[model samples]
Target: MSWTHTFTNLCDWYTHLLHNSPTGTIHIHILRNTITSNPDNVEHILKTRFDNYPKGKPFSTILDDRLGKGIFNVDGDYWKFQRKMASLELGSVVIRSYAFETVMDEIQTRLIPVMASKAHGENGTEIKTVLDLQDILRRFSFDINCKLSFGLDPGCLLPSLPVSNLADAFDLTSKLSAERAMNVSPMIWKMKRFFNVGSEKKLREAVNVVSNSANEIIKQRREMGFATRKDLLSRFMGLINNDDIYLRDIVISFLLAGRDTIAAGLTGFFSLLSKNPRVEEMIRKELNQVLGPDQESPTFDQLRQMHYLNATVHESLRLFPPVQFDSKHAEEDDVLPDGTIVKKGSRVTYHPYAMGRMKKIWGPDCLEFNPERWLKDGLFVQQDPFKYPVFQAGPRVCLGKDLALMNMKSVVAALVPRFDIRVVEPHHEPQFVPGLTTTFRGGLPVKVIEKKMLST
Candidate 1:
């Protein structure tokens, strides 16, 4: 594959190589990277032989500065310890309820009102308005994450929607960290860091800003005596004491996990919904049946019962996964399940974006945005994790999977039934921004008009 072309069209380039390859895999000699879209290979790397492929030094080096020793960027006992603690906190019913309540509060109090103000004129007269839905969702997710992760509200979704220094710094940190992976040579970024110049200088400033903010939150929580709070940071503090840096890492990781992924998923989902009115209608119908014409926030059980909405969310994830591809380095020489050799230090990646588009994996209509593929007999059907590793697979599967789905479903349940979102550039394909998460290059521009009727 041409490096120039791959750089230009990352997902498409990977899809072309994987589909055209006889082995469903391709190796880029220049980068010593192996890319695979095969489910068997994905299973082998993620589950069957998981230990051999750790995040390794190369992958960790890119994110280590920003993530520290957080669960996402670490491996071995470090990862296991953090994972166990996180699992306990994330699995608790009380925490789930807290998170759900936070999301609902944001949506009801902030999200809806802001969008309504935009849809209606500033003074409340009827007006057609265009807004960047991507920006709106990002603000929504950031506010929710701040509350759930740090037990603080950044007020990002307020009417003024003030620009947040912490949020901006976090965004720059993520972009620069991702850029470290994309550089043809690590030396480029390494030298920049050593000299404290250019993007590297900006990266350092951003990381410091984020770290200081996290430290302040942790300090304040401690000063408050780590009161019985429901947020993740509070729960973590209850477990471990007086380790500020470690606590900061945990909070930052959760912020990234909870904020960007869900925001990106919602942005992609709404963008797809604007083009596919039938899917939007189906979601509205399900919401109506589940929550009635009043369109109240869904209870846990009610959220689960909206299978069509769930399927639509799954379909959106299938197409535009927040993390398009993930790389793991081999600990030693090994063989993939499909007879591909993996040398020590090789970067082996399973391309979720490409796998989602592969006809062999998803059938002839793979490229189409059809939610029916995920539904059978009016119920949502679970797919093999290896084939749909959006939240990943095996022992390292995302612990926040349940929380993320609930958040997405709740937002859809509350919003879709009340608004008609029309994409301003329906025919224009938005380019993907290369970052830690998948974001649109410019933004998803749309016109959101409040529905006249309360019923679907």
Candidate 2:
């Protein structure tokens, strides 16, 4: 297949191959890449016989300039050490509660107020205002993640909605890094890098901006003397002495994970809800019953009891996962569970985006946006990690899974009850932008109206 075709509609192209191939795997020679939507193959690469599949040098080289030896970009001892530290910190009750508190504060103080201002007309007359919800949510998540991960607030969610240099640079770095994975040959990008021209130049500048900002934050925190803060950076600082470079890489990884993933998930969820009013209504009913008619933010326990709302979020993730695909390189020649021989130095990617649409995996109604698939006896049903690897599976499973879900649910609970959101172009299908994470090509534009009862 041509790189142009693969680039044009990545998810569709992967799905097409999965449907046609008997083993649910396809090989592309551009990078000697193997893409699979097979759950057994996914389990093999991610869990069973996992040692053979590492992020490898190619994957590391692409992201090393930006990510460094951060947990997401490294393998072996480096990844294991950071993973152990983060797992313990992220799993703590105190950290979870602190994260929830931060999310609620952001929602109540910034997100809701911004939406309310947009929903209410300047003269106090009832009028729906057109807003790009994707941008708003991105700003909202950026502030929350900065506060939670670095103990610093970028103030991207303020009334002015100021532009954030760190956020923009991070976005550019991530996009360019992902673009490297699609190159027909590494020589092209290597030549550009060697010449210090074009996108590579922009990437270098962006990485410098991001790195400098993170280093400044670290220096400031160090000067303040690592207080008993619950933020991830503070916790890591307590463990790893004074390595600011390592700290910067870790902070960037957490920031990317926390901000982009939540924003993408919420964007896809709201977009889907606009097309499916019944699901939105069901979510509102669940919220109304659990939190009462008052627009109070949900407590951790209250958020836990929101089964239907949880199911809807899961349904959204199933349909539009934040990270569409992940790649690993083989350490040596080995065979996948489904008898596909893996060659040493070959890149293998498992497609969560295509897996969600597979009839074999999700059954006959796979294409339907039905939240009921995730509910049984009015409680959210857990699918196997290999089958639903949106947060990924095995040892590298996301440490922030619970925190991400809580942040997402809190935003949904806080916003959905107070306002009605309608997609401005209801009939238009969003064009997916292929990058480190999946996001709409432009942005999700919507019209928001304050609910009369909630406003009163």
Candidate 3:
């Protein structure tokens, strides 16, 4: 279902379909898809029989031009090698500290100041600043991801709010590449690519812009000697054997992981906060207990103790997962845990966006934004990875999971007490853009007011 037809209610439509199904799984023979929102089916496909499901050639080919041999676009050894390298680097204390310090600095110096400048009223008036929070968060995340991946700042979040060619190109490429998959037939987009025309041409140009920029960064990292650097590109360079193209792919993969997902998550989190003032109050109370009002700057350790803040982020993700539905092609004919028989070479999709709304999995109040569901005795509790596959599960789980969470929490911790963000239209459901990430259309327009001014 296209956005034009369903008004971007595809996820909800799928949820309705799954709810009506006896086993919570449906096979569309025309699409050769086995779409499921069932936890048991998800667990079987994602973890129990992991090898039976892979990215497969069909899925990988769609992203190959932009992602190259990057982890997300591959299976087997390519995926395994990148995963191992990323795991080791991410698991390191140095990298974790590096990420925390980078996030803290960026939030304090760039993100806060930008929002503060926007929040100031003209001539001391009480008028609030109107901002596209989604756009701002994406810019904020792009800057941070550049630093994390290449140890460079593109100044995407500067007061001037300059447009970044690299970021823009990457976004276009992701959107168009995903467009290829949404076509009714693979031949349609593939033929367009063969003829080099229309949207495919635009996709090619955008990918070239992104690929060229990534290569330049890789070259600079090489000339500068990556042995001493702690950034992701450097660490990857040290691990991979002097293949600059491969290095570019690695860095680009990290860029994709770093930029959009966190921005989407935070955008949804604040939008929900605007609707649920009580949740906002509870978060502030938890923050007050953890970090005194006078203590403005939060340390990494202080952020860790913010269990409610963590829960709020989780709740937001459950409602608006960045990558709504993920698909894995079955390597062979297999019977799912739900007793649905998946044919060989069929796409097995687990719908996280739909699953989040399923009453069967989350009880009667599943549709509501309730952070307390994730809390037991005021401490955040983990859900089964299959049930909450937001960051994925098993061997291919997101390597940057912790870093993403820390940055998201850091942003909220820094700004929530200082400013208030209210969505211009809280009652309206967001129309999602057709892309690899769940980006809302119209960029989430909101009025931001300084908390001190609000208090007055």
Candidate 4:
């Protein structure tokens, strides 16, 4: 199968492997050599046999031109330092105050309206496709990252095609990032770059777009004598003085981490909700129960109380993990539990999508989209992080997990209760497109209706 086709239908491939492979392990050489379908092996490769694995030169080379020495694309000391810096900056009170508020406002004011408008028309029939849901979420995340990181809102959230170079750049940058990530050889990557082949030109253009955009944010922040602002840029400025590369690296890293994943996540959640009426009804019921009959804008604490809402989100993520497949390099030769010897330079992947559907892991109802599986007795039950691995397992787990959940909770709480979403005509079955993040082949299209609660 073509790599592009694999990108879209990897889940089906996993299903095939699960049924056919005698031992649930396969050594496949396609886009890259991958070992998957064995959780014990996946765990051993990531944890017990970790030292044998590093991200390796091939992975680094593909991301080097655009990401520089940022955390996601780098390993060893560089990664450790970036990770430390990110943890500290994200933990600060300034980001907690203004950054989250900025994100919340964008979701409330910008994203919801765009979605609601697209679901309807003057004629009252569904406009369908709503191609802009993913687009709007990406812009929302980009704008949030811009403001939180630089004290500058790129205003990509404004009702229009994104005018800012940064916003436009991120759009293509993420796409190229996926393309480069799939290539297995350093020489092949160099060849691709040397000939301006494959997604190389697009990646380079995106790099320029993101670099210039970051530079502008930095320049403007400095020009304003940014002592008054306590956002992430100002904090980073405190760390490294006027080094442009440092500034650019931080901005791009934030952009890379923040964008696309949440968009894909939101896409999956809503898509699942569209198909699964019981899950949607239960979530909506929890919203009403927690927020009360007349409540519109729910507070954070109120959001936390919606147990079924959380379960629905969890189940959706289980079936369709945002980061579907993740790779770990075996640092040295090591034996996986299934007796497969992972060579020192081998790239091994754990497919969370496959894990979620594993009857052994989640029971015979694994393929069913049932949110209650997460609940025990009358309340929600939290699954083991290692077992689930949606936000990933071990030390390199996602940083934005809490914020992403909070953001998702807020959006779903506000939108799901207030609007009844229905899939629009000739309904396209949701298909996975795998790269860095899992996304649908075409965007999900749903018609939403404003729900009428009992008389106030």
Q: Identify the leading candidate in terms of lDDT.
A: 1
> Candidate 3, which ten residues in sequence have the lowest lDDT sum?
120-129
Candidate 4 regions off by >4 Å? 2-8, 29-32, 119-132, 161-165, 183-186, 425-427, 452-456
Clashes of each: 0, 0, 0, 7
Give the C-alpha miss distance for residue 364 in model 2, angstroms: 1.6
Candidate 3 lDDT score at position 455: 42
Error of 3 at 232 (Å): 0.5
Error of 1 at 312 (Å): 0.4
Backbone clash pairs for candidate 1 read: none
Candidate rank order under lDDT: 1, 2, 3, 4
lDDT score for candidate 2 against the true structure: 0.88
Between 1 and 4, whose lDDT is larger?
1
Ranking by TM-score: 3, 1, 2, 4
State in Å the error of residue 14, model 4.
3.2
lDDT of each model, Cα atoms only? 0.89, 0.88, 0.88, 0.71
Q: Candidate 1, residue 276: CA error in Å?
A: 0.6
Winner on TM-score between 2 and 3 is 3
Per-model C-alpha RMSD? 2.5, 2.2, 2.1, 3.2
Q: Write the per-residue lDDT of candidate 2 for residues 1-456, one digit (tens) a residue.
A: 473444566687788788788988888776688999999999999999778888999999999999997999999999999999998999999789889889989998999999987885324464546899999999999999998889998999899989889889988998998888778888889899999899999999999999998888888888897668889888899888857898889878998899999999999999988889899899988888887866577789989999999999998999999999999999999888788888999999999989999999999999889999989999988888898999999978898999999999989998887778888898886778758888898799998877753434
Candidate 4 RMSD to the real structure: 3.2
Residue-wise C-alpha lDDT for candidate 1, range 1-456, written one tens digit per residue: 454544566787788889998878999898999999999999999999999999999888898889998989899998999999999989999899999889888989999888877774223455556799999999999999999999989998999989999889999999989988889999999999999999899999999999999998888888887567899999999877868898889789999999999999999899888999999888877777877766477888899888888899999999999999999999999988788999999999999999999999999999899999989999999999999999999999999999999999888887887788888889886788779898998898888777753334
Every model's TM-score: 0.96, 0.95, 0.96, 0.89
Clashing pairs in 2: none
Off by more than 4 A, model 2: 1-8, 120-128, 453-456
